[model samples]
Target: MQIETGVSLKPYNTFGLPAVAQTLVRIEADADVRRVLGDATLGRAPKFVLGGGSNIVLTRDVSQLVLKVEVPGRRVVDERADAWIVEAGGGENWHDFVTWTLDQGLPGLENLALIPGTVGASPVQNIGAYGVELKDRFDTLDAVDLITGRSVRLDASMCRFGYRDSIFKQALAGKSLITRVRFRLPKPWQPVLGYLDLERKMAETGQHQPTARQVYDWICEIRRAKLPDWTVMGNAGSFFKNPVVTEDQCRDIIGRDPEIVHYPMPDGTYKLAAGWLIDACGWKGKSIGRAGVYEKQALVLINRGGAIGAEVVTLARAIQESVYGRFGIRLEPEPLVI
Candidate 1:
């Protein structure tokens, strides 16, 4: 692979945060990764795998060797009696992949439409929206070990999927580079409309039974109304994970603030709406330096204009402290700050 030096990372990341990669290499295929690992100077260097740059906040210039994954391909790999197995190159746009699935008559991924980032980063973040998460449809993935230059495959059980997290975000953080991902979309498609926004859409449209394409359209419309277009305004979607608390904690919070928004989890826990908490703390439309909370949706942190990463971090920290001080719940940031 051709190693380029002094690459501007502003255009690479969704936040448009100012940062430079000292050395950057565009990995277009599995062989590219092996080529890098086989190199003398590059093989030994600490590396950072970058996908769509949609889920990160670049704080400073990167010292690690940045491998920008750009592998591209998508197709229905297999059709089983029970499900449709689809595979996509890690570099494929996640939203486009979802749309393609719908176009191909696959319907299970409709609920996750319009999500930013690449296919490779989806499992890394365990991305979820509406009533569906990546883990719900994941089949398998292929990754190349950074140290060994050998490719490996992992199933859902091995990925260790959790709320907005996976093994890729934990033990395998920078140890492996994902080259491809496969999804298992089950047959006899079912629409997930239990989410509040989807429910509201159904109420507005007066359609109790919606098709997969209908669900996809509704999700797109809902997200567009709530989240700013990152191309126009710099942002990394939701800024924090919806904090999950025990029943007692939820009861205590509800006792103090009856209007608090929360949903009971399957295991008897409660998932608190992070945006509601931030808005409740009076952070909506508030700015700290060049970074500010999106007035449309409090969960998003946006760059006002030419905002730096430090400003975003500062604003996020301030919001976190305010939320903790009032609700005693520490809001965890969703983006990787590097």
Candidate 2:
């Protein structure tokens, strides 16, 4: 474990916000994590686990000891008649891992292609897209406890996966560092085309029976068209979560705004489009300081050239307030601030 002091975090996060880590250590393996815990001074100090830094907004310098997870490996650990078990290190790029799975003839992860961040971070947010979620393909995960330096393996049930949430975000938040994740890609892969964008691709291509690679390609295309590339335009993909409302709440909002975009959930709830609400509130393409809402998609808040974390927070708060005042619904941010 190589430790560094006063490390800049601007390039670490996708948002490109400026910040510094007082002490940073690259954890290349599980042993490195244990080593840090074994150290008297470092072990007692507060620590932060950083993955790909895609789903976070650094508002200020991190005073805690930052453990940058860099463990790397990927392989099909087990091949069952029912499913193929693939394991990947926490530090592996999520999109690259998805692509690798497809290359290895593992098709179940195609629908989740192009998501930013690392495999370790996926379970924390239960990252989902194109009608599929991490829970759908998750098998189990291995993590090391920061305090006791003990390793634990958690299955799907232990994960307690919810819509863009998991135990990692709740009970285990900041308590452990996920080292690896395993995926159970079921046999006889079936494409997930229920999402509107995938359906549109089907209509446009005239290919109803699409392969996993086709679905992957289509999702990449759709995301490229809709969301900005974090490398070029500094921004986290979706700024706010799609607020789910009860039947009565949905009807009340529908009554007020007939054109509000929404979708019915399987559990008889309604998921309102946060972007639609923000757009309706006249926030698209608007700016405050160096932060601005993406003109192409109001759901994305962008750092318009050298924007600070505070500017982004200010812009997000204003949008949230306006959206709540207009629609009587609160928009929760998706990214972790600071």
Clashing pairs in 2: none
Q: Write the per-residue lDDT of candidate 1 for residues 228-316, one digit (tens) a residue.
A: 99999999999999999999999999999999999989999999999999999999999999999998999999999999999999999
Q: Write down the TM-score of every candidate.
A: 0.99, 0.99
lDDT of each: 0.95, 0.93
Candidate 2: tens digits of C-alpha lDDT, residues 265-328: 9999999999999999999999999999999999999999999999999999999999988888
Q: Candidate 2, overall lDDT?
A: 0.93
Q: Which ten contiguous residues of candidate 1 have the minimum total lDDT?
A: 187-196
Per-prediction count of colliding residue pairs?
0, 0
* Model 1 segments more than 4 A misplaced: none
Residue pairs with backbone overlap in model 1:
none
Q: Judged by lDDT, which candidate is best?
A: 1
Candidate 1 TM-score over all chains jointly = 0.99
TM match of model 2 to true structure: 0.99
